[model samples]
Target: MKYMKWPVLLGILFIHAVAAAQVPVVTLGPDFAEPGDGWDKLMQLKNGNTFYLHFSRKEGLVVNVYNAGHELTVTDTVHAQLWNTADIESTEIDGIFEINGQPVLFLQQLVKYNPVLYRLVLDGVSGKLVREDKLGELPSVQFRSVFVDDNLASHDFYVEKDPESDYYAVALFSGMPVQKTDSIHERIQVMHFSPRHELLHQGWLYMPDTTYSYFSYINMAVNGKEKVYLGTVGFNTKRNGSEIKPKVIFSALSPDSATFAHQVLDYTAGFANVGGTIQVATSTANVYMLLHVPAKQGEGNSSIILNTFQLSTGKLQKHVQLVFPELARNMEMNLGYKDTYKGTPQRFMLNQDGTSTLLLENFSFFKQGNTQINKLHTNLGDIGIALLDTAGKENTTMAVSKYQVITGICEPFQLQRRSKSEWMFRNKIAALNTNTYLSYDYIPGQSAAFVLFNDYLQYLDTGGQDRVRKPLKYAVDANFVCYRFYNGKMERLFLFGMPEVTKGYACMMGAADYNAAVGTYATLLISRKGLEKKANIAWIKF
Candidate 1:
């Protein structure tokens, strides 16, 4: 309930400094000795043990177990005959989770563009293989990025387990055929698995009909009750050819595959002028959708439309158009001009009492090039927060001031022009309570690019006259800040000064996860050394 300003007080500064000093850095194994491509994943088990998992077809799957003190205790490798195929180059590892006190690794191998999934469970202490089973597969499916979904709308492979029931399911989707010969087709394959990795039920669900000419975006989520929900937004060509009408559809598939329900959300009638992005979020009992609809009659501003659905009965519960007077004021005050609503929902935090927090980033693109060549930048304009209570009413709306610029190259390895430096502000937010959240900002500050290029703009502005732009230098200023939010207000907790990370150590935080059992925050880092890379997990305990 108390507020603290930035440049925090002396007592608050001491608290932050102490927490920063307790951060732990764990290094993985030595560099690769073989000449093959591989990836590593870090996972924490249920029994308070951690493991660094690395696998390559040539070397098989290896597990390096670390104790509570972050010391490596065991190293185990499994070289099964299943990975001896010739098409090993098309193999992909999804993720690692636990089953019956053993670590199970999920892998997908592509055979002629189709996918075959395999599950292998390893012993915790000895790293020996406990069981190896071939799960299911979807033929003729394409794979996308597992780390980041770049497509505006696409399906992702999900492997989830029900904690209470100890049951699991795998959902895989194959895109429609390039040549549309059929109107409706089976597009999704869902497989239910037991705790021992045995396939229980398999079903195929058909996607809604769409023309071959029209492009569609689809996203899916599975609930704890073993139900799969699909939310799709497509633009179909009208008969008069005057304009393309937006269509939105929702589908639900039950666990036994006996009951399938489909509902049309009045795509053409309700959202005749709406078209941007449709993001879907699901709690245990409800499905929520946030649509960035075009506000103006033709093309002036945008509006956020929130729709809630009952997951059990597949019924539309409520639909409300959210108003953001505070966000408009924040944009006008910070950017000196007001733009349309461009909030892209990234994180949806749901509570037990049915309240949800929708965190959005005002996203836009920047073109930085002259008449000759151009590059696109993903500009993070600002941050927006919306809270929806149990009644599906948006009770509060708040916008935070934050601007970020993303470049093409990963700044940890490559260098660009000094004028076009790659600035990064890494942060993470986690729910502290039903109505409060905490965000940690770890900005080891900006660095000037090592290279310079002034020809792109100079050629367009001066008719190819000047080439030199400015001298280049490397610079960095590191610091960290924390913020607490509750009831439509934000308070700066404290800011701590920090030493810069040495070269080859990519201090940029890739991901953050909270360990509920330990009550600590863990940050994942991708550290590179020339051609080799290491996975470092930093634990921040206060």
Candidate 2:
């Protein structure tokens, strides 16, 4: 691969001049004139020849269709009800390969005080209702994210299980209940459905005891062998109070969910009272857990622990602890450094070659009077690339320069390998009062790393030893990057979306190209918007 230098490069200068000549054109469509106060949820769906957008307002939920020319072709009012009663909390569209091989849109309707889970499927072509099925009585469970697997004939569902049940007792509480009833085991249920929506597997995870106190968050992941990794919170009730332990339990299931094997990862045993997130990447067999330790509890400074475990051997490779040194010095740093902290060391980017980069944010403090106020002035996030040597005793650690001061927010968006020595990072940057976000893809292949940011990708070229800014004419929203030689000129292809501004929050943008089949590709955007908000998915075709 040929590595290009940044800044002083003639190619960058030429591109900048071309980008300056191109004006951003914004074409507005017909207004969605629904009498509503706040527009909360928005989802975009693309079929073969059409695009569908579904949005919810204070009034009801509406669906609008558009063509490739950006013209609104069809409008459908899916459902309407009184302001307080009707609510569509979640909507998912899946391209089902079976059953006539059509795409189906599943909308989950939730009444404010009801416990029923309503399911509705919309036809992909006509935008009409194909079928509606009531998914029976559900628990008083809060809404979580949903997933649909096309290759597999089952839909895996996960929800918060009740803590007072016998299943909860065995799986989490670490103690058995005095009295066990039939209803106790039915408190929490994990349901798996067949292709035709038939119940395949439904049962509760056996717990130790039926205690009112248990861990809060529960996340599920399926490994290569189809074993379910249930990352959950476990609690122990002693003479004092309930102590929470963050644990990842692996459960092996047979085809019918009748026979199973279970094991708890002992590496995560000591993690107590920490409430963070866990993600497992099957391709790399790496499990990353973000732990939030409380500072006031004398648990030391709050930090994120990156645990690398092998799926084949079920052994932990390395446990790296990430902590913001500056943030730890501030007395005003509360538990988990929730307030007055920009970002934690939880941001991670896993490379293809088993190497990874971790992004950590630190904060400084200033004394006003009797009270001390911690201010996030500097972003101490550095990219640490770790490579395991054959001896395993000598692990190489390559640290990059610290990033610019990003106030109170930072995230690892995209990490691309430019060359043998260089890597590129496209991070989503945001600050206070500045809603605009940009992408900075750093090319580490060359001597002077070049960072591509926003429309004008800026880079530092060692060839000229100067900084240069150029306009990258490719569309910004799509995940896939295309380069082609047309008429002796390099042409880039991209799909553009509406520009959005972040409000008092930072966002992490991620993009990847997945090959669905031969000559077919899907561009996916896995973006984490707000810290507390859910990660949204946007898929486009090229």
Candidate 3:
């Protein structure tokens, strides 16, 4: 006897309708110009009402801040004292967030030598420097990333005052420690600092073994409580003198950042040199860990795995694996086995619902008669988004709109989802054959606005494939997009373009927020081309 239920099916449809009603509409508008040179980073603030841009120029580094409504508010310049040589080290915008209810920006300046971290406070309206401070020296060691959390109330410099401190502003460094025996050894240290600029605690990560290790990414989450998550790579040397057998370790910090707990999430017993990158959301639902495992020893064939850990359980209970078997079919395609190689499968995103996505960027084949005329092997890179149900089932696979087969160096691709069924994709926007980076905003009812570097300015459909608008060539090196609502109509906001010294590279990094009254956006740009100088800061108003 078979039974059929109609009421249950009807209830599902009714619930879906309610969900759809809650999703916001996205609208896009015509492009406008806001200008600068050698732009690099962007940040949105005041709920998406203001924008900050930074860039570098031959003369020095420059910054421009503007309103999302297409108004220029503040422009400031910082001269780089070390621009004698052409080769310059990379610089990064460390953190931009509110501290004590006031807006502050932290810039991490790295030259060829040791790194120096600088802190600058910005007046919310004009983007002027309210105050400035230089933090501390980083022992000439390499750093993977830096973050600022307002919840870290204790400073690292004053740890002796209280051994049971709950919060400490921290800096993570990756490199080898100087040895008295004149031998180099790898080490990772977390330098904790107080809110008023004091060192509290500094120590090496005590691992179970003597294997060389490095820290890559830091994920900080703020809920009713605060938590810090770290991703690490562990490797051991083989008897043949070659490094082999790598593993990934996941570590978590207590709510107060006083104690540490860790576990081996993935064991690289079969795969060699496995590593991962992790990111935690502002909401502490889950942690996204992107794991990379090479297929062979010192070979290029590799797979990307996305693992999700339930914070409550502190265990990896879900994973999505992506493999490319075609790499094994060709021998000449082999390259030095490393995680940074282009065209390898790279894990992109891990959504809130436990769905994960990965990006395949490069394609290669065996060289034949002519290197240029060889049978072109289309990589046909793919994006996969999967949902892991609470029952631990891989139940759904979300459809990803395909991307075009782009040649030459491509910028890091960006992905955003508007709804359960809709997603957006765009690579770093740059010049022809030159790697390009792009910054964008996706409004549900509005269109997706992307700012690219190349001489050409362009727009793509939601799928990131169809060209909705033709290329508008501009002399600026970087650009960003913001969304504004006026009289019930949504509009796209554009900022001035800054010239970049690197052909296809731009320093523009930005973010946005939306609420009831207004939407605020901000971008940071370096106005110069070379690395030996500090970039200026620009704040945009919308």
Candidate 4:
């Protein structure tokens, strides 16, 4: 009788967990298995279709399209010979974006050091490849993907899709000539394409002076109103200084004009350097930037600077300089090499109610959304979130704690003793191993935001038992977990039960996507059975 009561109570708890707490609808797609060493990207389309694109050296490219019922409708292979070659170098899924109510596949791959992009058009209902074309002038300078061995490949490529319409833009960095004192930079080709994948204009992106020496692409947006905007960061070559300054270069290219509208912003009053990542975005008529600058002359920790500017008229809208005093890290003690509490903005997500939020992360080595709209993602970090309000100038930075460390030559301890050169080495080293299992992705909400990642199985149980002595399980042995945030607090939980050794699954946390209107968070699941592996699409909804 006691056992029967326990089974009934367990069933009731499971039902309540599904209906009350975050309910997960983990529906694995059809049994589509692939050989080892491949990549998968799950995209939730606007027209209620989900496309799962998979690629490998052995399978070439296989795409599975699913309908709104989460039923697999079509499976087709594109570029069959492209990935089957032996000398293939760098390959990446640029993403499947909707153009003119149709799903268009964007891919970048290099064969024998030659880089090129592919634009594939699929039938909306059939999911068959309707068209395929090579995009841009292959950067003669041998530009490979970002995670490739060395950036010495000399070229960089990224695709930007317009949120307001089907228009998209491709900016291909051909190569930079020998740096000159008088010239900015050269060979950057910007091509604007229509929703139907038609080329509208092809021109050069006017860059800033080379004195800064370092340039990082921030964001790109194509406004439905005939304006295409690009944002970037240009910082000085100062390893350490109070006068260390970083600048924001916002350039707008229009079909009506032959030249670019440039706004070069250097906040001399607020001092910052290349101490962290710079995030900037282009709204309908304005450009916003968020960064963590080195603390003031005598201060110990870093500060946050948010700049909002009118895009067309080049007028300053709002300049919010944020300083977190209570949580200061006294970073001035470490020659800017060590950051005890990170303030660098990793993500800038625009909210629905005319407001935005910037997510910052730190590691001690553990701690821890946005649009505007670049389809870009950061590596791994702990967590710090900054919420900006437009109605009231009330701003708040919330810090959440979690223990995580991406193990490799790019381990966290090495970052403590390394110089700037060694720091840059870890930056590239992260790209070398490409641990898709180590990162976190979030589903931003109005009332509460949900953060998801992989962690140990013991993390599933939060009975206050000490986990300090427990062995850590990561990479393939990790379990999918979430940090659900609400009311200024976070509740962490595991998404699925603990997996056994031979039969288990690994959630590609980096490949996850969310649909707010649909109330679903989607990602690709890699399930293993004995020696066989399978790739399936999984969706979780609240």
Candidate 5:
């Protein structure tokens, strides 16, 4: 890799930081109309075509077909009965995938208050719907977000794709009840599909004692057509069922078996896996999970225990207790994060050397004020990375400094249903939430791993606290930063000069697309020069 002077390397300079790295050639496309609400997803098909999928509540699915040069050719709204439902709340984007060179979108509709799953296949080149089919349905069950709060929205239905193969698993959990009692029971269903969206395995997971024990949805993963793993903490009551003792369990659904194989990882009242999740290593047949152990009678610091389980047999392989101070020392990071902090696992990367690295997001959620003047704050930002060997031993840890927030008047969007929902309203339709632009994307490579995010420029030093007590002005100071990881260390460089990046255009990193085989990453750089914001796809090679 050779270094060259970038012509657009504007006034803001970090001469020594980049060390004269090769600047990626960027090509901008023609401007188009700005999209509406819901979410935006970009996908690159195998035929070298791209689809800019815009899913909204009132307008349904809008597809934009772009050529290899990133020029928009075709733009149309998908004409499907399920897609354009009369009531927008009834339809939800279950999952989106590019299957066999065509864009596949799984949609869920609550028809007559019952959930039904539908799949729509769009033309890879034209962005037009070719086929629509009814996949399956679930009756007498409640489907909703697993963790719905003022700032966070977690879905109960998720799709996990196999990194090594074309196999994928679609799983949805719902609250089931009306058992002539008050408590509503929980039920989960799984469906496995092949490369061409062929059904391979389907069944309802036997979570636990349907009556005595209730489970909390945590995470899910799928392996090459053979297994769909579901992680949950089963809660059971004692002495006439008045309380609940949490037990972390992993259930595997295979094609050859008629029922799920269950393995209990933790069954103690002293510890809980409330916010923990599972990571299936692609290099080896092992699944990793972190269990939080609170201080024993308030004597010592809290502990994070890592448990390794065999993927094939659903058995415990090994367990290790990590030292927080030592791990922080290795990363050269601060332990105190504005008095109190938390580490939540957000992603897992499988290295070529059979070691898996776990990435933890540092954040906290708390409420302030009394009843009439209450507010909930999801204080997010900052990161922690733990490198674990094959035996679940912690080899190293890394911490990242960040600062982001969401606030203002939050009013409840009332639905006919009993559950309350909060919708943060903005005055204009085209104006999006600033926090949406302050997102990150990750791409793993053969030689080095890359992370793309936006944060303050002053937080470049690694020794200070990752997050401060008072929130920083991310909207004014945010800049695109790229982190390259290799040889057990990392380097941070601004993707572009500040003057060039502040030119009304911002990268929608949350909707970025990456091709591991070709080593190219694409994202829509939306320009805010006018009310009609224009979008251009920016592609960079690794």
Candidate 6:
């Protein structure tokens, strides 16, 4: 079972007790756990159908489907014999698809790097499995879908439904089988399937050369029906075991054939400098690539290179370099290379009004220990904005200075660490307007209304805990302050206060989703009393 311990809530209730007077819009559910309670998975379908699933050691998996009106629609179960086969102990439902206007569940059980998938077609009205089949195995990589030999991929696998083609695309990176070779080359497999779970196209791409033993760092962007750009930035280690500057390669899917339109961009022609990180973005008609390269060999300040390509012609549309002002005044620690001035382009969005925006977040990681368990502390500091015209030319550049830190104890194979940190800031951002976005900070409830970027000294000095390890307490109150980002600026927005509910009531923000049908955001959590667990929901309308 995934348990959440509220350590910060004690400080929150003592400091912001007055702010707890406001009532929040919320709803609670009855007890759903039966004896042996495990982890719960929440999902929202494309057609606005939502459900919460719970797995048990004896009873299998229980799914409770809900409509947009927050009403329970159906309850169904999939037996453990169907999923817990052979050596696999866990089963994950990748997606629930409505193929030919009927519902089907896509499940997978991972045995090492590969996944054994299953498709269970369900009767729409009754929520009963009409038919089931093993969809066979596909080649896949473990580290967040992208081909990250360096293990820096932030997200997991990439799975999406093409709006125009009505086809599903899935991609993952994995090592080659032992029988294939003992080489260091990684395999990137892209699979296409029909909405009815029919396999359409299966293709694989291999690393071109061994010069980049640590190659295949990938970031992808999809446009329309026919285009899926898989971009990679890898360091060349061919020269005497020394890591060199990163190079880029793009593999765009060709709809007509089972091949990719590969393109290579060289950043080492002019200088011998090294590139830091790379990101890719796409719109309906264009694809953009952003690369961060160090300004000078020893200088810590980094510069960005933007390369835009036309989707139709596959031609380079624009190339530009940008250098922004240091927004590190808000950064907590201004010392060392890890906390130095470095920028990473985080988001790119094409608006309905024909304008596009690029959002960049300041990032740094500090290594506390030499071990694997508690080594690095990640920090998200300040935001930078760049507005672009239709042709992908930069119009203006601005910066938003706000510091946020993510530091907590994450023990492997422990329930205390699973849902605790993952759910705290699940839905961190909400759109307020075309040019405005809002982000919530979780520290306003602690009397100090400031953003607490986790300090490395604090963590090391405290012997690897956030503050001090104490007994786990179940908290009911959640307080947050909103920060508004508009036209490249950041300002605090005191919209309203969070709910001050009783104990045993908390929001399972890990399962949050924005319901367009109801114009509200909802999440499910649990109220725990000793060994008893009950499912509850909290919704907020914006």
Best candidate, lDDT: 5
For candidate 4, the lDDT comes to: 0.53
Worst 10 residues of 6 by lDDT: 429-438
Q: How far does residue 148 in candidate 3 sit from its true spot (Å)? A: 32
In each prediction, how many residue pairs overlap at the backbone (N, C-alpha, C within less than 3 A)? 1, 18, 103, 5, 0, 3
lDDT of 5 by residue, 352-398 (tens): 44576666555556675554323554555666656667654566555
**Which wins on TM-score, candidate 5 or candidate 6?**
5
TM-score, cand. 1? 0.62
Question: Which 10 successive residues of model 5 have the least lDDT summed?
Answer: 412-421
Give the higher-TM-score candidate: 3 or 4. Answer: 4
Clashing pairs in 5: none
Per-candidate Cα lDDT values, in order, are 0.45, 0.32, 0.37, 0.53, 0.58, 0.44
TM-score of 2: 0.48
Q: Arrange candidates, best lDDT first.
A: 5, 4, 1, 6, 3, 2
TM-score of each: 0.62, 0.48, 0.53, 0.72, 0.77, 0.60
Superior by TM-score: candidate 2 or candidate 6:
6
Each candidate: RMSD: 11.1, 13.3, 12.9, 9.7, 7.1, 10.5
What range of 10 consecutive residues in model 2 has the weakest lDDT sum? 417-426
Ten-residue segment with the worst summed lDDT in candidate 3? 1-10
Question: Per-residue lDDT for 528 in model 2?
Answer: 23
Error of 5 at 177 (Å): 3.5
Judge candidate 4 at residue 9 and give its lDDT: 12
Give the candidate order by descending TM-score: 5, 4, 1, 6, 3, 2
TM-score of 3: 0.53
lDDT of 3: 0.37
Stretch of 10 with least lDDT, candidate 4: 1-10
Which of the two candidates, 3 or 6, achieves a greater lDDT against the reference?
6
